[model samples]
Target chain A: MNDLTIIITLIAIGYIAGTWAEKRHYRSIEKREREFLDLPAITIKNVDIDDAKVKNAEIVYGGAVISVDYFKRILAGLRNIFGGSVKSYESLIDRARREALLRMKTMAPDATMIINVRIETSTIGRKSHKKSVACLEAFAYGTAIYLKG
Target chain B: MKYTARMPETNVNVTPTSPLREFFVLLSGVIAIIVGIYLLLGLALNIIVPRIPMTFERKLAGPFINSMASVDRSSEKAQTAQKLLDVIQKRYAKLPYTFTVYLQESPRINAVALPGGNIVVFSGLLEKIESENELAFILAHEMGHYVNRDHLKGVGRALVFIMISAMLLGPDSSAGNLLAQSLNVTEMAFSRNQETLADEFALNALHGTYGHVGGSADFFIKLSKEANTGLWGHYFSTHPENLKRIAHLKNYSRIHGFAEKLLRNIPAIINKKRPA
Candidate 1:
C-alpha cells in the first residue's frame, strides 16, 4: 500500500485506541449503568391532549422505534445544514406517538382500546440534535395508564 | 504708491488656504475619526469577552517568557538558574513534577508563575529577604499554582479573549488594541478565597517541615511593611495590600494554633515523612 494508506490506517487505529482508553477509564471509576428511576410526562408544546384521567393513572411501560432507513433520512436532513426539509423527521415523531400509546397499553389493566390520542410535531435546529445525539438517533417514548371498563 | 507693489509680510495679503486644501484636510480628519472609532470598538469587545478554560499550557508560557525580555534582559540566566533552584525543590521531592522555580536577575522584588508550571522569581527578591523561610513561603505559594492548575485555567481564559477578538474584530489588529488581551507576566492575582487557600497550604508545609509556623507568618508581616513603599506597593494590580494579607495570616496562625500542633507531632511525622 501507499504511504497515505499506511498513515490513514495508523490514524484510525490511534482513534480507536484513544476511544477505548477513555471508555475503560470511565468504566473503572463507575462500573454500573445508572437505572432510570423516573420519567417525566411528554407533551407537545402549547397544545394539551385531553385524556387527563387515563394519563394521570401511573404510566407503567413504553417504547419507541423507527425504521433504520427512516433514521438515515433524519440524519441527512440534519446534515443538510442550510438546506433540506426538516419535516422529514416525521418518522421519529410518529415513533414517539406509537410509544406513548404503548406506555398506556402496558400500564393499563386489561385495557381494550385507547381514545383521544393526539400527536404534535416540531422541527429542531441541526445544533440541537447534535447536543442530544442519543435521543436523535431513533424516536421518543411516553406512557398513559388506563383501566379496562 | 502702488498698493499692489507692497512687498510681503502684510496680514491681509496672506494667501488664503485653497478650497481643495480645505477638502483634503476635512477628508483626513474624517478618516482619522473612523480609525479611532474602530480601535475603541475592538478594545471594548476584548474586555467583554470571557476567557475559556482549556488545557493550553506550553503555547501560553512560551510567548509570556518572550514578552518578559523587554522588562528584564537576563531571562537566560533565570532559565539556567532553575537547575540550582531545583536543589531547593529537591527538598520536596514527594510533590509532583509540576512544581518548579525560575530565578531571573531582576531588581524588582517580584515573583510570578506563567500558566503551566512556569514559575519565575526575581533574584532581587531573594537578595532583599533575610530568612530561608520567607523564600520557602514564596516558592510554596507558587507551588499553589501547580496544585490548583492555575496556569491551565488562566491560559484558557486568555484563549477565549483571542478567539472573541478574532471573531468580532480581525485577528491582525494593532498591538495597542490587543494589549487588553495580553497575559500579564505576573501570576494573575487570584481571588481572596484562592489566596487564603494558598496561604493555608504554605502554613501547613512550614509547620510540617521546619516546625516554624511562626516564622512563616512573621515573614508575611515583614513583606507587608516593605510592600507599603517603593516598587513593591506598585507591583500588585489586583492583590489586596500586603498588610491585609499579613493580618489574615497572623489571625489564621493564632486561631489554628499551628505552632503548638507542629511541636506536638514533630518526632513521629519526621520519621514518617508524609506525602505533601
Candidate 2:
C-alpha cells in the first residue's frame, strides 16, 4: 500500500484499540464493584478469636508482600508519573495497608501504643513468567499497651 | 495511447468522506463517553453513599481520640454534670439499659455514647445549648446508645470487617491481612436497619424519659440545618442522614401533641434572646 493508505489504516487500528481498551477498563470496574459489594457476611462464631496478647496489653503487628507482575508495575509507574493521582495502586495499596493495621490492633486490642510501624514492597519472589496473577507483600509492627487512655 | 498530450486531462473519482459520517461518528463518540461516565458515577455513588457510615467512623475515630486526649477533665463542671446524669439515670432506670454521662471539658458542643456503655457530653454542648429540656434531650439520645449497646456493636462491626477481609483474601499474606484489619468500615456505614433502629430507640427513650413530644424532633431539625452547613460532622457521621432523620422526627411530632409543642417551644426559646 502507498504511504497515505498505510497512514489511514494505522489511524483506524488506533481508534479501534483505544475504544476497546476504554470499554474493557469500564467493564473491569463494574466487575470489581460487583464482587466487592457481593461479599458474604463473615460471621465470628466464636468471640474469643481476638488474640490473647492484645487483651494483655502487649504490642504486636503483622506484614505481607505480593508481587505486582511486570505489566501491572509498568502501568503503575506510568500512572505515577502523571503526578496528580494514582488510583490503580489505590485499591491494592489501600487494602494492604488497612488490613495490616487491623490485624495488629486486633492482636493487641488493650494496648494503647502501636508505634514504630513499617511497610515495604518488592518483586523479588514474584513468578515473572505468570501472566494471570500479580503479588505484593506488606509488613506492620507496633507496641500494644492495654491502658484505657 | 499515442495521444498522451490530448488525453492528459482525466477525472479521478474520489468518494470524499461525508460531513454526515463525521457528524454521526462524533455523535456516537460523545454518546459513548457520556454513557460510560454516567454508568461509572452511578455505580460509585451507589456504593459510596450506602457505605458512608463505615467511612465516617474511620475518619472520626482518630479525631475523637485526639480531641479526647487534649481536653482537660479536671473542671468542676464534671460534678454538676454527673449530678444531672444521676437524676436522668434514676428516672430512666425502669428502662432496659443503664445510662452513664461523662462531662468532657472540650469547648465543642456535642454529647454521644460509644458502643458498649461509654457516654460523653462535651462541656461545649452544655454551654452552647439554651435550656434544660435541650440538655435533657441530648442526654436521652445518648442514653439510647447504652440501651442499645452501640459501643459494643461498633467494635463488633469492626471485627466483622477484619473477618470478611480474611475470608476474601487468603490468610497466607500477612500484609494484606494486617491492612484489612485496620479499616473500621462498620462505624461509617451502619446497616440501614441499624440506623432506623437507633432512631427508633432514641425516639422511644425521648418520650419515656422526658414525657415531652417535640424536644427530640426539634433538636433534629436544628441539627439537620447544622449538618447542611457542614458544621456538625460528629452528628452527621454517626446519625442517619440529617434530612431523613428530621422527616422521621416530624412524623413522631405529628402523633404526639406534647412533642409538637416542645418542638415549637425550641425556636421560641432560642429566638427570644435574639432580635429575629
Candidate 3:
C-alpha cells in the first residue's frame, strides 16, 4: 500500500482503539474513586494524628506503567514540532497517578487515611531512533495509619 | 471476629479523556498555521529572488562556496569538465549571468549551484557519465538552478530559519539541536521542489543543445538502481526519487518531440583516460 493509505489506517485504528480504551478506563477510575472517597491520600509531609491513638500503621505503595496508543503518539509528535503542552499525554499521566493512588488505598482498607502520599512519574520504552514516546510509568506511595477503635 | 491481612489488587487505569479532542484540534490548527506561513514565504521568495542583480548574488555566494569546497583546476578530469561547460555556455549564449564551472574532487556523485553563476561539479559525477550528453544534462541542471535564482532563495530561506530558530531555542541547549534537526528535514522538502524545477530546466536546455533530451536521465537511472536498500533509505531525502525524476524527464521529452531524436549509440567520451 502507499504511504497515505498506511497513515490513514493507523489513524483510524488509533482513534477507535484509543477512544474505546480511554473511555473504559475513565469509567473504571470514576467508579473506584467514589468507593475510595473516604480514604483520603494527602501530599502533606507531616502527619498530625496522635501517636497514642494510632493502633496500626504501615507503608503502602502502588505503581503502574501505561503504554501510549498510536493516536496520542501521533498528536504528541505534532506537538513536539510546534512546541506546546501535549494534553493527550497530560491525561495519560493523570490516569496513571490516580490509579496508583487507588491501589495504595486498597492495600490499607482498615486505615483512616493515607498520609504524605507522593506520586513519581517517568517515561519508558524510548528508543533512540523512534520519534514518539512509547510508555510512561507512575508510582504512588504513602503511610497508611489505622486508628484504635 | 479476628481481622485477616489481605493484599490489595493493583488497579490500572488506561482511560481516554476530553483532552484527546483538544489535542487533535490544537495540532491541526498548528499544522495549518505552519503550512500557511511556508506557502507565503515561498511565494514571496519566488518574486524577490529572480529580480536580485546577478552581480550582487555572485558576490554574496562566491566567497561561501570557495570556503566550503576546494576547486581542482589542474586535474585532467577538470579539463574534460571545462570542455563540457564551454559547449553548454556557447549553446545558451543569452544567459543572464556568465557561468563559471568549478571541478571539485569528491567521491560523492553530486553537483551544486551557488549564487551568482558558480556551478560545482564533483569528479565522482564526472567519472560516472557514459556520454557528454549525460554530462551536459547535469551541467544544464545546475545552470537551470542559476537561471531561476534558486541558490540565492535557498540561502535566504536558511537565514530565515536560523534566525527563527535562534529566537525560539536560544543558545547552547539540546532542545535547540532537536529544533535544528527538525527544521533541516522541512528545508529539505523545499529543496526537493527546487530540484524538480531545475530538472525541467535541464530537460529543455538538453533538447536545445543536442536536438534530443536523450541521456538526460542517465544519472538518475543510475541512482535509482542503488536507491532501494530499505524503507528509510531515501524517504526523507532532499532529492525526489531518482526513478520519479527519470520518469518526469521522459514525460517532458515526449511532449517536446525530443524523444524521437534520442542517440542510439553511446558516445566514446566514456572511454576517456582516467586522471592519474
Candidate 4:
C-alpha cells in the first residue's frame, strides 16, 4: 500500500510538472526559433554560394539531454506491454532535437546558413543495471557559413 | 534569395496527442484485460483445481515448501500440533493430505494452509489458544480447505499473473512486482461462502474429535476483543469478519445439536510464557 501511494504521487508529479515544463519549453523554443529564422539550418551538404563570396566556415554543434517524467515512463511501460507506438516519448524526443537545433543556430548569429546539418539521438543517464528509459540525448551539428560583402 | 526560413506549420515528428488521454486509455485497456482474465480464470479454477492430482500438486509445490524445510519442524510445539492434526485428519476429516504442521516464530495470530499439505502455525496464534479443542479447530479449518481445495483456487488465479509478470518483466522488476501485487489484492477470493463452509467443517471436526463442539469459537471470540490493527488485519481480510464467523459457527453448531463441553487444556510446551 505504501508503494502504491508513492507510485501515484510520482505519476501525479510527473504529469503536472512534465506538462508545465514542456509547455514553457515549447514557448521558449518557438520564440528562439523565430529569432533565429534568418540563420537557415539545412541538411544539404553543399550550397550554390561561390567560393569567392565565402568568408570563414566553422563547425557549430549543440546537444540537449531531456529526461522523461514518471508519468510518461509509466505510459511507455504500459505501451511496452500492449506493443504500440510510444506516444508519450515522442514529445520528449521532439523537444530534445528541436532544442538542440535552436541552440546550434544560436551559436552562429552572423552565419549566412548552416549546411550539412545532422541530428543524432541516443539513450543515456540510466542509473540502474536493468533496462529502463532514463534520459535521451539529441545532438545537432552543422557547418556554419559566413559570406563577404 | 528566395529561401525565406519559416517553422513548419505542423510538427510531423511528434503527434499532437493528449498524453493524459493516451495514458488513461492505455491504462484502462490493460485494467480491463486483467479483470477479464481474472474473471475467466476464476471460473476455470473451479473446474480445474479438483482435477489437479495430488502427486502433481506436491511436485509443483516442492520449490515453495522446500524453502521452509530448513525451518524447525521437530520442535516441541510442532510435534504437539502435528499430533493433534493427525488425530483430526484420521478420526474426523480423513483428508487425503498427510498434514504436517510447521511452527513459525511470528507474532501474528494466523495459520496458513500452504499447497502440499503444509499447515504453517504462527507462535502468536499458539499463545492465543487456551484449549486443545480450539487449536484443533484452527487446524481443522485449514484441513477444510483441502476438502474443497480452496487454497489452490485462491493461489491458482493469483499465480497466473505472478508467473506472467515474472516471464515478461523479469522477477525483480518493480513494474512486474506491482502488477503481481495488484492482481493478488483483487484475485484472492477467499469469499464468504468458502469461509462459511470451512467454519462448518471445523465445527463438524470438533464434534467428531471431542463428541461435542466445545471451544470452537473461543479463538475468534478472543480475536474480536483484541486490537486488530496491524498484522491482525490480514487474517481478518483473508478470512471472514470475526463477528460474522463466530455467529456462523454458533448457528451451525446449534443446528447440528453439538453442545459446548469442558475445554481441553493445551500442552504446556506449546504455550507462550508471559513476561513477569
Residue A96 in candidate 2, Cα distance off native in Å: 31
Q: Give TM-score, chain B, model 4.
A: 0.88
Query: Over the stretch B42-144, how does candidate 3's per-residue lDDT look in tens digits?
Result: 6788788878887787687767767864875556566666667777777862477777677776656678777767777776666677877788888888887
lDDT of 2: 0.49
- Residue-wise lDDT of candidate 2 within B149-267, one digit each (tens)? 45545555445444544563445455334544333333356444455565566566556567764456555666665654455765566667778877776676566543534432222
Top-scoring candidate (lDDT): 4
Cα lDDT of model 4 by residue, A23-86, tens digit: 9999999999989988999999989989999999999999999999999999999898888789
- Report the lDDT tens digits of candidate 2 across residue range A1-149: 24335534544553455335534644553454343332211212222324653444343776644334333343444444345344334445544554555555556544444545555544445465743445555656665444332
Better of 3 and 4 by TM-score: 4
lDDT tens readout by residue for model 3, A2-101: 4446666887788788878877987897788878877778777777668899998889999878779877787777777767666667768877887888
Judging by TM-score against the true structure, name the best candidate.
4
Q: Which lDDT values do the candidates have, in the order given?
A: 0.47, 0.49, 0.73, 0.86
Q: Pairs clashing in candidate 3? A: A22-B15, A22-B16, B58-B116
TM-score of 3: 0.53
lDDT at B243, model 2: 81
Top DockQ model: 4
Model 1 DockQ class = incorrect
Residue pairs clashing, model 1: B51-B157, B52-B156, B115-B151
Per-residue alpha-carbon lDDT of candidate 1 for residues B36-134, written as tens digits (9 for 90 to 100): 654454445335422423244545566776676533434444433354335435554234544345656556666776764667777656555544556
What stretches of model 1 exceed 4 Å from their correct place? A1-149, B1-93, B172-190, B227-230, B260-276
True contacts kept of each: 0.00, 0.00, 0.08, 0.59
Once fitted onto the true fold, the runs of candidate 4 whose alpha carbons sit more than 4 angstroms away are: A1-25, A36-74, A83-85, A92-149, B1-13, B31-43, B59-66, B69-73, B173-184, B187-191, B227-231, B262-268, B272-276
Tens digits of per-residue lDDT, candidate 4, B127-184, equal: 8888999999999998898889988987887677666666655666677677766665
